[model samples]
Target: MSERRSISSGSVFEERIGYARAVVDGDRVHVSGTTGYDYATMSIADDVVAQCAQAIRNVEAALAEAGCTLADVVRVRYLLPDRADFEPCWPTLRAAFGEVRPAATMLVCGLAEPAMRFEIEVDARRR
Candidate 1:
């Protein structure tokens, strides 16, 4: 049987957020909802596009930690604070996943942090 492993960069959430950044089980890796915040600095980027890019980067970093890459991603979830923001950032997302063409869903809703404009999460598998 395969074992489950938690993916963390030694960061901790002060609140009672019952979640890990990512989890690896066998050949599969699942990343939790990731925001635009720079985990190193814990600050959200100012630009929406930049934030979107950073969010994806963070996802990729998590995947890499699990011995995976963006190409291994099979699904993604994008959460935007507004539809307008989603429209403008659609192209960026498409370009990022152009080759992978992972199944994706975009949503608009309030995020945990006000400064966060976009959040992304992904699921990846490796053989």
Candidate 2:
């Protein structure tokens, strides 16, 4: 059997909701749906583009803790309440995943917090 390890970003939500920011099991790393809030400040930006960029940074942090980077990501999922926000965020997302071109999906759905304009989740394989 393979070993499993959990990583945390020290988000209060993780403690209340009982979840890790990411988990590493064998060669695979699964990052939880991460919102745009700067975990250190527990504050989020109002602009969707800014939120998108912050969300990627948050995901990258988790990926790094899992011994991988965005380039190792094989899948990505984006969640937003408003579909129109997706296009506005494309450039930021492209900048991160453009080279990797990981299998991707975007969903229009409500998030836990109304302030959360964007959320990102990813899966990566450790090289």
* Model 1 agreement with the true structure over 1-127: per-residue lDDT tens digits: 9979988754455235767788999988999988877778877778899899888888888888999999999999999888788877878887889899999998889998788899898999976
lDDT tens digits, residues 39-78, model 2?
A: 9999999999999999999999999988899999999999
Model 1 gets an lDDT of 0.85
Distance (Å) between predicted and true CA of 126, model 2?
Answer: 0.3
In order, the Cα lDDT scores of the candidates are 0.85, 0.95
Give lDDT: candidate 2, residue 108.
96
lDDT at residue 52 of model 2 (Cα atoms): 95
* TM-score against native, each model: 0.91, 0.98
Off by over 4 Å in 1: 14-16
Model 2: pairs clashing at backbone N, Cα or C within 3 Å: none
lDDT of 2: 0.95
Off by over 4 Å in 2: none
Residue 112 displacement (Å), model 1: 0.3
Clashing pairs in 1: none
